[model samples]
Target: MRGLRKVVTVVDEVLRDVGRPVPVPVRRVAVAAVVRNPWAGRGFVTDLQPEVEALAPELARLLTGRLIETLGGVERIEAFGKAAVVGLDGEIEHGGALIHTPYFGNVLRELTEGTSIIVFSDDRLPAGEPLTVPLWHKTAAATRSHYQTVQIRVPDAPRPDELVVIAGAASGPRPHARIGDRRTDPVVRLADLEKLENAR
Candidate 1:
């Protein structure tokens, strides 16, 4: 809370089916916060939970609020993901510590009314580096078209002793997806069985 610095929001939209009878437009919004890395310069600490627990609710509220606002409220949100990038001064574990908590994702799932478990990824990266956060249908994780990813980079952020944590929401799935679900599709199952039989 005390180290909370700045919040940046990015919204991306694409109309893949530009002039078709059924237009397909996908929109995703990402909100990221720059914060002081509590463990920076303090050396390795066995107990990182204290800081993670303390920061989860605060970061969650701020980032989730910004995402909802950027997407103009949450009803349109179809998928969600979270990411944290720690600076050179912090360990990858420090970055992972932020978004890997149950509290962090649970709050997001509740606020967005998303039934499926939230998707997430975190890493330590330099400024201007891209961070790809994978996402899935909020209510149907197995939906093929709903699988998506949001990529963002915070220019001039996480300056050695900082962290850039992001939360993202999407309006819908990819455009004109016909591949079907790999998990339960008949064709996919047949392909898998064929592969197994051929291997044997």
Candidate 2:
């Protein structure tokens, strides 16, 4: 929690869709922590591993805990993702260093009992700019119904020498998802297409 500035959490619930009541509301939550960037103002310092080791795991645990609590529990988390935004004075890689490594992502994965790799996004932006965190099914990456996103922003954060790290979760798939998953969708191989062309 070193150099921590503030924590922000947002919850979005979809209770109705197309003017119809949904049986189970879809809930998406995002937790973000604005922290001072350790590398900020240090021009081109080579190795980030030491600070990454020192910070990522604890940050991950804190954010993930907040996300799970806001969502009710780990069982409520069916989809998950992460994101980070670095302030203007910081490198985009500074944000990437915190959230991209296993030290950060694996904590969420382990706590949620998720099998699929957690999806993510990272960028450099000014304070108060909104960022969208992309999410997918926690256990099945190809589960199209669970593809979702949560947008988060802090009005005053990442002040030129800081990073906003985020974790996102969804309680369920999109309300009334009708599209089938990738596993059941028909596959079109390039070889088959070539054979068809030759026959034509």
Candidate 3:
């Protein structure tokens, strides 16, 4: 199927005036597309690989370019993520088809040189709804400041026969990150039930 009916982009900049020793600022952006759902309302299709292979790279290229443009350049980006929202007529896997493969991440990793995995969100939604795309530091998952989300809302998209696919980027981590990464830091770990409750 020839995919990509439309593309949408959103960017947000946040600033903290007094949350830390010095003021903090951040930039986050997302690029999403509304495309014809190749499998929607169709009977069981055993092989979805061809469709996936055909679409993943193109979507990755388009989104990554937009992300670079939004952030001024690829060098300015520190975190990355992706997401998709399928139309009512489509299956959840339709959304997954677009964002789950390394074919997609390969583009982001090559361009951004992001070592850590890309976070994601995929769900079925109607037109004019919000899709929250999660973000994380490229190589430093333990860095608290890089965890973020890009929320995109298309006024009239992902119509019954469509899917909303997305990619995202961030200039830095959270403004005031007191917590550490659960993946690397020992402090951010499992705690005894008694100690956890006592602190609360």
Q: Could you say which candidate leads in lDDT? A: 2
Consecutive 10-residue window with the lowest summed lDDT within model 3: 15-24
Candidate 2: where is the Cα deviation over 4 Å? 189-200
| Candidate 2, 85-173: lDDT as tens digits | 99999998899899888899898899888989999998888888999999999999999999989999898976899999999999999
Per residue, candidate 3 scores C-alpha lDDT tens digits across 91-187 of 8888787788878877777888788878888899889899888998888876777777889999899899899889989998776776856766555
Residue 137 error, candidate 2, Å: 0.8
Which candidate order results from sorting by lDDT in descending order?
Answer: 2, 1, 3
> 2 or 3, which is superior by lDDT?
2
lDDT values of the candidates? 0.84, 0.92, 0.83
Q: Residue-wise lDDT of candidate 1 within 1-200, one digit each (tens)?
A: 77988888888887756454325577888888999999999998999999988987788888888878777788888888888998988998987888888668778888888888778888777887888878788898888787878888888887899999888888888767678785866654788989999999
Q: lDDT of model 1 at residue 185?
A: 67
Best by TM-score: 2
Span of 10 residues, lowest total lDDT, candidate 1: 15-24
State residue 155's C-alpha deviation in candidate 1, in Å.
Answer: 0.9
- What lDDT is obtained when candidate 1 is compared to the true structure? 0.84
